[model samples]
Target: MLPPELPPLPALTRAEGELIDRYLEVLDLLGRINPARNSGTYTGLRAAQALVTKAAALRDALTVMHNRGESELHGETLARALRVLDGERRAGLVTVPPPADN
Candidate 1:
């Protein structure tokens, strides 16, 4: 479930919305990148995964900034993204940190 503190997306500008879409695309692309863990690993793919994660965080932060009513949106989205990435990680599609201690 989305964070209740998250304000609606109505306040986002067209460009901002586009950025969010781009971030989602990045995530999709990340899923497509082969980890190639067999032969020395694909550092490029891992790098792309990190880049996409950072992009998503930026998108969420911008969304929250545009709508302060959902001050926790960025954190919430990051958490959800991490969960989705967990599935990807388990499938050997990407490598990220272990789940948060909390």
Candidate 2:
């Protein structure tokens, strides 16, 4: 059987697109660095190190938006965009997992 169709992504300004992309990048790095999720210090350390750069890029995306006079965040629209981008799953990786059943 054919897979279910996915919803289309919301229309976004160039800066907003960059913002979402950068934010997801940071989220991914954080997930990798999450101690509860990771077993190796070296892997977490690498993700932690990369977190600094990804965070900076996220900052830059926001700064660009501000400079361009996009002051307000459209939460509803962005939330849709994030959902379309699998953000829920990506974000879940950063959170502490539920207790394991014995």
- Best-performing candidate as measured by TM-score: 2
Tens digits of per-residue lDDT for model 2, 45-67: 99999999999999999999999
State the lDDT at 80 in candidate 2: 98
63: Cα error in model 2, Å: 0.2
Q: Which candidate's lDDT is highest?
A: 2
Worst 10 residues of 1 by lDDT: 85-94
Per-residue CA lDDT of candidate 1, range 1-102, in tens? 765553333444444445455555555545455444323346556656677676777677567656755443454554454444343344444454356798
- Give the poorly placed runs of model 2, Cα more than 4 Å off: none
Superposition-based RMSD of candidate 1 using all C-alpha atoms, in angstroms: 10.1
lDDT at 49, model 2: 95
